[model samples]
Target: MNAVSAEPASAAASDLPAVHVVAAALVDADGRVLLAQRPDGKHLAGYWEFPGGKVEPGETPLQALRREIHEEIGVRVASAEPLIRIPWRYAAKRIVLDVYRVRAFDGVPHSCEGQPLKWVPASALDPSEMPEADHPVIHALVLPRHYLITPQPDADEDAFLARLDAALARGVRLVQLRAKASDDAALRRLAPACLSRVRAAGGQLLINSRSDLVDEFDLDGVHVTAAQLAALDARPVGAKRWFAASCHGPADLRRAQALGADFVVLGSVAQTASHPQQIPLGWSEFAALCDEAAVPVYALGGLVRDDLDAALAAGAQGIAGISAFW
Candidate 1:
């Protein structure tokens, strides 16, 4: 749901409607992202995107991602799921973009139709070097590891501190103190204690919902929602500033790039026990998606340490998963 309700005061604001689309976040081995130059005759020619295409009539977003990857690159995608959706307005059209992570597929990729292709590190892309559409995604591509510290509602301050210390000892570089059941007052009281530990351990801290906290705490960055990434016009804060987004797919990738996201987490790669119906895109397809990506991509969804080699081959900078990380 959109939060911006105010009409643009200028006549210039009402000229266009947003375009809706579906995109893929694919990667390959060796920690490099894939990028494809738009063919000479197509829209946004010479620009790049995470490979995949529009969701055709009657097909779901993942289905479209599968079809588009195969059709365009001649590889068969095996599994896939939601990454992020970015609803945006471009110069020529407005779009509601759905993006996905293609996990596995069959066959080596080749441009069935010729277009320029390159694999780059997520850390290397220069927004000024390309089209404007992927700017925010570039920022998102750089976010370092940020672990969410789980604190129970009933835990006492001492116990919470112990958990925080344990996490720091394990070399957690960043943290989000996400305890919803714990009230704001308690969190406030806990913040100083937690931050002291974090800083002593040489870690960065971020209060999940508070940008103000970033300033107040002398911390590193902010964690935002897909809505924030979608609505972002230009980065409102720092350069070399870290911002994380909960994304769904291409539109989200575009928005994240546009807003200058640090990095993003993409979906369940395999069928998890919790989601039997959420079938995953195995591996081949995942690599192809990475092939067209310009920013560092991580493999999310049902991932494990064992999947790292394959994911890297597919072009992800690293792996990101609820189950995979711990």
Candidate 2:
């Protein structure tokens, strides 16, 4: 499905009364997640969604999640981890969908509310069949928490391929090959080798160059640079391919959303050797900016695996980096 622009949680949405809701990506041991079809007469009836309900007064989001799960699906949540927080606006109401990944739950999940329940692999969850607010959740479920941006390739092609293989072996499921100095000829030669290795590892590779190369190289997608984001009048790639962008502020984000970018890499969240002169956004500022984003965002700059929890807490899809990843 093509990426759809998200309704930014801006001041206009704030004017509406906010409804706090909790939902779960109830995962089974086989990695399939549970989906509930909205019953007739409900607001979004006939669409499938992550099962959840409104949070009552004084209840923590987790509390509401467990309570709602039991009431709606006849299962007791033994443990749940924060997944994604989505701020969405409808015609008359605004809602914050506090979602969780529930892998440990008691009892089998059956429809307690007479709604139909289905278990499907995360990759099979269709965004069109779900609410717009749940779109990011699907991305979160399908994407890796860590995004790897390759450093410049060495003069020796085999050395570069070996390093790429090593990173893939380390469990990096998503990668961006960003060799700015390489010419098209060099990239054309290197991309296929990278793509073959990444695919063999069951991962996807995105090129940080012209979108056309994605089709030509048979790669997974294109990563739009901030400058490329500004120059674009429309989405550079097709809906079937991943389209990601790099953004530093609100304007770039708006452009990305308008261009239907699947996800975005934002910040200099922390000082890094690559861009030491630039100031870091810190976690607070990063969170503030994330509130304005409609799609999944990966925290960039000077981040490692240890920073994943902080990134997620700040509403990021995960963290991206060059050195730490390579």
Candidate 3:
């Protein structure tokens, strides 16, 4: 996520030889992404993955990406952006996979190397069929760039709903309803209204530390607090539902990954009214944590829409905030 040098310390630490690879998620106008199957004799034969190959000596990642796309699929990358970086280890190899979203390209994609290729809907791309390293890439491809954490509902519920509707209309696609001050009955009443509005706006709603209500309200997912993350041994939600966690440090992140969390929100990256006394991680520390993270992360606390670029550059999926979002 930091776009650090291709040969970083993490790669050197591994016993296996370091291999740097660049891949492209070629997106079409209809939002489908191109995937190529590994040929019969290659490693992980028949497994599907984003089209790419090893980065040769002296080639920048962008250069390797352009070269790989043309050789594998017969297209020249016209425009692209970084998506995610994965540090992965197989039984006998180590790899640092640098992936990008190919937004614009010159020609239709075909299997130039005689490997099978298909353009599948982003949501339909199954991680189970891909190499383990590409799983996070699928998450990056399908998930939105901005996540909104809802503020506490006020005494006037109508005003809260109106404010939520406006945020949804403004393209806030992923939301977490964090009404911790409300009682169970009040939350039960509010959940449906929030879900209806979120769905109507083509977004997903996750409940804050409330896995039990997810099924009853037909919500999208649950976001667990750090305490809850520590208490759980197994993932609380089904595969179709998202399971996210709030993590403050390395231990929390390790625990969340052990529990197979879909993603995690890591921060207080900046000071905020919600927790003014607490110190922030700042961009440097945040990027350091992200370097070791296997799952997508969101930078929370005091982040505005303008911080999205900074957050992404720091290896985060996006920025999530209560005040700026709501």
Candidate 4:
């Protein structure tokens, strides 16, 4: 703000050391994320966030989380693992926040500075009250991180069901049922059976098109293509199913956000749906798109199970693809 602060700001912003990985934990208990209010005089003070601190040089993010929790909250983080990464730039510097899910931890959390801490349920994680840097991280954490499953054209019902079962056995509880058959009648006829298999497997399904099917059948959701999202309207998400869409750039993401989409699929993060000539957005472009959205953006296109790590590294909610899950 003033000349003194401006000098330090210029210095901090310019030669930021190897982007330090800061670890944070969404400590959920009975559906709430544990939050600690930043004390006055600290960066982003007065804003509420998950308790965490910077990873010191030569230390791992997880180790930093454990030490920070103990130092700031007087509690040891028993265990923590990857949740998401948020690459954000403040007026002073850029930070690559490595978030983790702390499902196992000991002792009650308390702020050393005596600021209040509370467990706010996901349903109650009011956007207006959360710190700006945390908004995308919260969205990504709430999403199911679904695995996309596409049925092969002309594949038998039994074979399809087997794939469905295999996916479920591997702990996949969410899927997108995309069977690109040529005939309209065939796509229509295939819906009921496919929906049946998904429900039987105890997994939720999303149909890429056929809003009519969303009406006729009580499927889990609908995923609109990127084209559809661009010209999107604020239609009733309808009570029967969740509504989502596909997005690539900032425009598509903004449209989906305005349309009140539950989530969105963003893609070609790693050369998916290869046409040889088409190159993927890779990590940088993909992460920026993810940061722009208000809702979760699953990494799609050319993603396989192996790509999930890279996807998270790039700030995606998770990987989504016909090839990724299978």
Candidate 5:
């Protein structure tokens, strides 16, 4: 998967009029999103974009989405939610796109104009073909907001399963089953029940640092450590699942992005008991690294649900935690 590179900063970054726009990822039941190609004579002609148009004055972002989606695609957006707000600058103009996930709508999408349109699978999407402003939108569409890393698995199966159940009930949609003390056979024994519980809750489970286990048990994904991430030149070729990495700095983040990872976790943002000896990346440092990231980053270590606002403000997608999340 060739990732899209961020556009170079233009003179217009500081001087151009910032246009407000609303866009939609019209996702179908097949996990495919609708994309539109710019027609001739328009700015960025031949470039592909999510279907939407400029937001008019006195209209909320949702209102703009409803109106633009209906006009551009001929489908009435019945329900949509905020996905991401990107402040980007093209060579000629600056635009702030408030992108949404169109969860429910009325009418089949037909090209109201002569623009070409296609429904693309999320994984099959080529971000390089999209406008630079939409690079973050692609990340938002593929990655979830919250990431939960499990604590040390107890020897007692019932206690461990109970804890896992509680976390899922509390809305931990994406989880990493990190069982450091367990070996291949032991972890394999735990996998079936864990997989069942996660699937039942409509959640995705990624095994930590164990690509072999992911294949063996048919888990949803694999979360590689920073060291493991650096060692990889290409993405895993076997069963397709959500791939992520633990990144500590720009190099790790870049490598993960280049490897076509779905997302990355960057931290010890606030320090943690797990790595008390390591210096935490303070909010300022976290923000700086996150700004350079191409994928949606989750701030890990010393973060709780309460820190969600701070994390988002610092440019992180959300918070990831072990102790706090459980």
Candidate 6:
């Protein structure tokens, strides 16, 4: 309901009624997230959304969230952190939804405002049941921020495992094993050691361009190349692996969405040593592409930990990189 409020004070601020809303993803120990139905007679009535409300004149987003959730659902937010901010437009209003992950709370949630509330498993959230502006928020809730695409491992196998360990230690929870130089036989040989390190750290690892190896290795998922993505008519059925795709532009983004990919990697947001000749999509271009994307997009090329906040501000899931992460 608060996706209608937050706007920066600027020359254009007065042009539209800016609704700076703060919302919370109240996650329970079972990994379930809470959703509340807007009471009748309100704007977008009967819509299901994260519990939050309009930010008052002086309250910060965090303050607004705690107050709103307390008032709306009768729970005191104990701990929280920023998640995603979505700028959305309605007919006569514009809203900036400042979403936060409610990691812990003090009391049981009840519909203090007489709204229906439900706790849904994170994996089971259906975007179709949510308001249009909320689809991206669902993606942010489910996917991790940093997506690691491995550089080709050095000939030293032990050294490679160490590198993977370091990346995981640095909090890279999502990984793609994109060893372009290694053939299937070599990748198969490396997989066991690589998987062992990632799995031990509780990170998800997906084989790049090799969906066929998924069951053989009992891996978490697959990342389809653009060529592979173009050839597919539908998401591979019955295998039950998470799927992501490498996407360059709007068309690729559309295809990835149509095929139901969990996410897509987009960019060369800045020039990289790996592709010295390819022009990069400056942040402006990157933001434009991301604005149209239905699925979450991870900005790739020449990005590092420092780029995370800027990437999120530009509407990215996070940054993906070879050298920066390695």
Best-fitting candidate, scored by lDDT: 3
**Better model by TM-score: candidate 1 vs candidate 6:** 6
When 4 and 6 are scored with lDDT, the better candidate is 6
Residues 1-326 of candidate 2: C-alpha lDDT, one tens digit per residue? 11123445556666987788889999999999999988777767778888888989999999999889999999999998887777666555677778899999999999987999999999888988887778778888888888999988868989988888889988998999998898778888999989989999999999996688899888899998999999999888887788999999889988997788889999989988867899999999999988878688999988888999999899888999877778
Tell me the deviation in Å of residue 167 in model 5.
0.8
Q: Which one wins by TM-score: 4 or 6?
A: 6
Kindly list the per-residue Cα lDDT of model 3 for residues 204-250, writing each as its tens digit. 99999989998888999999999999999899988889999999999
Estimate TM-scores for all models: 0.51, 0.93, 0.93, 0.67, 0.71, 0.73
**On TM-score, who's better, 3 or 4?**
3
Model 1: per-residue Cα lDDT at residue 105: 64
lDDT (tens digit, per residue) of candidate 4 on 90-145: 45775666678787878877777687888887646765566655665666566666
Model 6 C-alpha lDDT versus the unseen true structure = 0.82
TM-score for candidate 2: 0.93
Cα lDDT of all candidates, in order? Answer: 0.60, 0.86, 0.87, 0.69, 0.81, 0.82
- Model 1 C-alpha lDDT versus the unseen true structure: 0.60
Which ranges of candidate 4 are over 4 A from the true structure?
1-25, 28-32, 35-100, 110-139, 180-189, 239-241, 272-274
| Range of the 10 consecutive residues with the lowest summed lDDT in candidate 6 | 2-11
lDDT of 1 by residue, 144-254 (tens): 433543444355788878877876787665676655567778867777787899889977776554565666666677666667667667764576556666555666766
Write model 5 residue lDDT over 1-326, tens digit each, in one string. Answer: 01122455588565867778889999998999999988777766777889988889999988988888888889998888766666655555566677788869999999898889999998677866887668767877876678889877877888988988998998888889988789777788888889999999988899888887777778988889999998998886352577889999888987987787877899889878767899999999998887666567889988888998888778788888887778
Each prediction's RMSD over C-alphas, in Å, is 11.0, 3.0, 3.9, 6.6, 5.6, 6.2
Where does the lowest 10-residue lDDT sum fall in candidate 1? 1-10
Candidate 6 residue lDDT tens string, 23-69: 89999999999999877877677778898889999998888889999
